[model samples]
Target: MSDYSSAFTHCETGNLYSLKSLIDHVDAQRLGEIKDKHRASLLHYAARHGQTDILQYLIEHKKMDANLKSENGATAAHDASVCDRLEALEYLFHQTELKSNVRDERGDSPLHLAAWYGSYPSLKFMLEDQRADAHIRSYDGSFPLHYASSHGHSECVKLLLKVAPDTVNGQTIAGLTPLYLACHMNHLEVIKILISRGANIRLKDEDGLNCLHAACRNATTEVVGWLLEKQNANVNDCDYSNYTPLHYAASSQHESLITYLLNRGARIQAASNGNTPLHVAAEYGRNGSCALLIEAGCSPLDQNVQHLKPSDLAQQNGFTDLSNELKLRERSLIHKALPGSNITSVTSVNDSVTQHPKTSVVRLVVRKKNVKRADVSLQVSENEIVNEIRQQSSTPSVENDTNRRRTRPFAQELQAKVLEHEANSRREPNNSDINQNFNSSHDSSQLLHSLNSINQRNQAGKTRAKLPHDVYGPWMKNLDPDTFKEQLNTVHAGLRKVRRNSLVQQEKYNSDDVHVSSAENEYTLVDTSNSENNDNTPVIEESIRGKEFLNNQNKLTSKTESFQSKSGQNTINSGPKHNQFTGDKTNITMPQWQKELIERKKGIKA
Candidate 1:
């Protein structure tokens, strides 16, 4: 048996003498019994290596079966055709009773293998001389043209298309055509050949994914650009799940392809399950894609159908830095959206206060220079001013009695200053007693100086206040009664809505078991645990850490269930599978046919 194995090796090297010497040691019947790991006989090896003389001697003298199949059902002719061994193939077909169209275990005939291996000479000879059936489908329901196109064998593809032109658009079991395969593999010339021969670019697969979707999924930038620019393929074409080419590009994490698609009018906000490209990028933890989408004006606050934002997705996926960046951008956008005047300076009112070291005195100074009225300088505590406004508005106080007593003196002093100014202004300007009273004492002298300064400021032209009037305004004077009521209602409604959302979030955090909604279950991967801190907010564990926790929980739950069931009672499982909470939906939840198609595009055997 060992000697017979060496005969197979000799057949491959075309060493006829060694092969014959080995065959003499073994009985002739033993030759038929020996095969390699793939069940390939000496004739299969000889034909694969183009050893025509050895093939002839094995067939004519040794009476080896030319049509004998290996484990994969491939005969000597199939082997020869795949290796481009035209001479061996010619001898086997002409001198023996072998057939050209005999299929292997995968239902692939010699013509399919020849086309798949890019054996241009063997494929041409088989098609021109042997009249091989080009229309025959493999087990995958793909014709020879599909194999040639997918492998980027332009010559073989051209030959197959010329013989059977109708097969150019023929699809496999997955609904993938020759043009779609060519685009997926980025075979530009083959794609061009197929299109010129009337291949439809608009054709989609069973999942409703078009050639553009296939190209973007593989990050075939050139093919994508050509399809969009040359063929006019729809950049916003949606799949069965409503995923556009932009969504596929984002999932691929190819920044350049995403940018190119965007420039070609790919909709950045195109939604799948209400998730835009930014959401997909965030879920996959694709930092570059997220940045690109953000730069292209995608809002981080855009929520999916599950009410999950991009930042939420990023945080769930353990991209802490990316999540924080998205949150910061969201804040900046909201700040910009607010109606406000261009501020000269933004200083906190509390920062302006100074306390004396030797005395119990605090000085609070607020000066506004560009006001429509006189430039005012006030020396009063900010707390006292707030209290005064609150008192005037009749608003309920939340401050302690001690704090109220502390602010009373400062508020009284502010009111006294205002009252004095009003009284002095009411006096007749030409009265001699009033003039004397102002000039008699040092206090009068100080008061006269302040009046002169106020008069000078009044002579200067008035300027509008720098503060935004839209937000802090005299609403009763500026707006009609109906408009004022409407604006007030809007503000109250917004506050109520915010309150509701915060309550919902709090509830979700406090609960021991968090069950995701059906729409969100497909995408949520966060393992939220209640924090020990006083805030009561949930701490989101990283995805990897979450998976470990879920795995431990699952193991414990399974053991408990087995024990309970062994005691003659049925146990209801309470833990979800590790896969349920983890894995990217774009890749993990994709259909099996699409996965196989992707594998084929990457030149991987399915």
Candidate 2:
């Protein structure tokens, strides 16, 4: 049995003498019993290896089953088509009763196998001579065209499309159209051929992703550029997760792709996890990408859903160097904005300038100074205060320049007064001198208080009003709770009133008696005679239908008259307006113009 099966392998290589000797040794009755583990007979091998003479000898002379199927339900014809055995296929079609359209377990016909393998000759023969079904869908709902396009078989694709152009947009079970598969496989030529044949570029797969998304996934620059530039694909197109091409490019760490998408206006801020392109770069430890994104104006302070900034994410992911660099960049930008605001830098005693980390930040420090209790407090003179006030008021009224210059002198005068008081206290340190200084200081203190009061009032008038209790400022111990409570209560009351009214209306409507008309179930019968036939039958007037019916009648008449004049017909064909209808049927002939208008209204409704 093993020798007989081995002889079939020889038959696949077109060795006729070995195949005949093995058959004779095995006896002709046992010849048909020769099969591999997959149950494929000698005919399957012969067709697969393009052994035309061996195939004919097995089927015609040895009486082999030409239509014998393999474990996958593939016939010798399918193998012949896949292996490009055109001569064997022709022999099978002409000499045997084999079915060409038989599908394997995958539901693919011989045509699909030929197209998948890019066997141009087999595919052409099957399509032109055998007339094999080109539109047969596989188990995955993929047509023969999908296989050819996805595998980059340009010739097979062109031939299949030429046979059946309508299958260009045929989708697989995964919702992958031929164009999308081509892009996924990076078959640039197949993509062009499919698109040229009217394949829909905007078709989204089951994942809600387009061809551009597939191209971006594979980082195929040519496919992506063609889709964007030639196909007019949306640069900012998103997937099911709202991820744009820039997100994919960033994740792939392709600098060129990232730059290409960014330059073409791919949004860098589109985030799936609240992380921008910059965050993705940092999370993946893509240092080059991080720098590129930062230079492209991606916000550094963008926080992910976890409230972690890009730098924090980098540090958490073990990219400490990148994290530190990002922190330094942020600090540098802040420092440049404000030259130096209450900040000072100090180097460590043991640290050298070259060895110092540029990431070190300058901090502000405040130290309290010890003050001596003088026997007398310093006071500004009344004449000096008055002179300073007069000079400030007499300063030029040009603008802020004059106001700034005028205020500078007052500050200088105050400094001078303090210095003079310190000198006097040092020069004379006697009890008698202390008493005299105390009295003079008392007079100066009063004048200084008056000048300071004047300055506060002037400054307050020119400054913008501050909030009552600013959160960004130092703690102020005074706040009125009653005023805040009053405003909050007013807003709450207004909201409550609106909500109550809505609830009340809802309750009223729910409790009210609602009437439903049964007009469709009843018929209106009118009597055309002046005399009543039956006393039991109540007479209903036309006015019961009210102003709406009258308006409609007037509109109909006017339209009919206008249409008549337009068609050069003076006579009116509106049959009759019956006052009462006696039967179930109301016969009123509407004009052509009326019918046309009604049709136009119907079309608008549809």
Candidate 3:
């Protein structure tokens, strides 16, 4: 018995060539020289491997088994036919005598497996050799044409039909003709070839689907168009899926296909499962397809089987703009006039600088029109708009100008104030003072410290610190909570009512807690007062005779009540033996009559 695993390993590893040579080199004779694939002969390996040189050598130089069937029941010709190896296949086909029928494991002849792997060259070679089987069906009743058609092999389909046109409309195991599978698999070329070979385009399978209908339902746009226009297939055909070609195109979100099909006589209003093209688009949020459908004059007002319109479907899909736009098409204006309220006239006085990476911010700076005010000034970047504003204004002074500019005390004060603000912002504030000048044209500097610093920076290193992320001062956690609480206080008065109501609800709960505490305190207070009264007012009165009498009475009453309760409970628990000790062996013994009776009873039993 041969070791199958070892032999298979040898065959795959090409070790068989070497190991067999060694075995024969020992004068192992013809037995060792002759070799085969574990499950197949040399010709089978030759055909499958496509080694034309080796196969030629094997045939011409070394005469071995040609029609030898291995353990798999596969002939060399079958392997040659299954794999598309033209030269080896040709050699094998020529070597064997012409045979129209030879079945493999699947009961498929070499021709059927050739068709299955779409080995076009091999199939053609087999056909040319007149060795190809056309009418012979496999175990599943699938002829060569069926496999070729099912796989969308166009050239092979053409050749099969050319050799055996009678099998063009042949039905397979599923009762489906070759044309049906071709069209369903979107094999446009195969469909064309089959149609040219007199294949029926109207034949349906178990699904009541003709070629055209399946093509459309599967979003096989090219196939559908080919079937309908080229082959003049039926346009109005439907399937058991209850869907027309138009329903498929829209449902598949194939906008271009839908448009083409619709133009090519596919029904635009055609419905399936109660949804029109527009309804399907809206429900599924196929925005591009929906737009295309609407543009194609599909009405948004069309209803589904559920009686819901496309616009309603759009609203359900959160198509807010589309829904509103559709409604706006029918809208009429109600009012035209607009009203306005209090507006402040603001005139900036200083050359301010502001800079931001994403947007421009206005910074305020106040300076005397004539002299360089030392009042706190900041540096910022210039945006185009602020530059235009500066260009239209007077010449700006440098913040570093010391002697050429007379510094005012007011300017110093301004700079200090600005520094204080920036410092609070966690940004470093300049302690330098501004020139003092109330009469100078620099009164608005305080308001524009951040804004004025916007466009002009004497030093290019500073960046504008904005909003909450500003880093001027050290953060105080206590201040942060109070500030946020104050912010809540500044919330709109209407929300204040809600806040107050929430506070009141919380207060009610607190009030309940207070009531509980107060009740407990009151009870405690009463008990404490009674205890104090008992201690202070005394069990005995201050009168000498009354004190003595009252003390003796209280003691006597306390002892008498306790004794009575205990004695009553003991009597209640005891039966007739009230004074007898039940288990006190030191104090009592069993009754003499009972003991004697026990002894007499025991003696009789024993």
* Every candidate's lDDT: 0.71, 0.69, 0.56
User: Global lDDT for candidate 1?
Assistant: 0.71
How accurate locally is residue 388 in candidate 2, as Cα lDDT from 0 to 100? 54
Give stretches of model 3 more than 4 Å off: 1-16, 22-46, 52-78, 86-107, 128-130, 150-154, 185-187, 217-223, 251-253, 268-287, 290-606
* Consecutive 10-residue window with the lowest summed lDDT within model 1: 348-357
- Order of quality (lDDT): 1, 2, 3
Clashes of each: 0, 1, 38
Report the error of model 1 at residue 543, Å. Answer: 92
lDDT of 1 by residue, 1-606 (tens): 564667777988999988887785655467777888888888889999999999888888888778788998999999998889999989988998888878898999989999999999999888889998899899999999999999999999888888999998898999999999988888999999999999999898999988999898884688888888899888889999889999988888679999898888877654546688999888888899998998997877566656667777776777766767776776565445432424334322122211111222223444444443221222232334545555654544657556557555754555566567657745533333443333333354455555544445445634323456666666656787899899888976675554444333323322333332124322233222333552644323223343454364443332223222524543334322212322222111222232344445546432
Task: Say which prediction, candidate 2 or candidate 3, comes out ahead on TM-score.
Answer: 2
- Per-residue lDDT of 479 in model 1: 85
lDDT of 2 by residue, 39-135 (tens): 8877788899989899878787877777678889989999999999899889998899986688899998888898889889988987888888888
What's the C-alpha lDDT at position 53 in model 3? 56
Task: lDDT winner between 2 and 3, please give it.
Answer: 2
- State the weakest 10-residue window (summed lDDT) of model 3: 330-339
lDDT measured at residue 65 in model 2 versus the true structure, 0 to 100: 75
Q: What does each candidate score in C-alpha RMSD?
A: 34.5, 33.0, 30.3
| Residue range 1-606, candidate 3, lDDT tens digits | 153234333433445465355433333234223445455644566567676655554555555555566666677677777778777767765664525367766687778878878998888877877656688988777889988887878888888888888998887666688988787677777877888889887777776767776676564567776667677876767777566766656767567777788787766653444567777666666677777776776655444545455655666667645545443321211010111212232212111211111223233433434445332122121223345454444444465355225334544656667666555534221222212221121334543563455333323435654655334444433467778677556654445444334333322321211100122212111111133355542121112343453354243222222222343343111212122222111121122332345456547766
Ranking by TM-score: 1, 2, 3
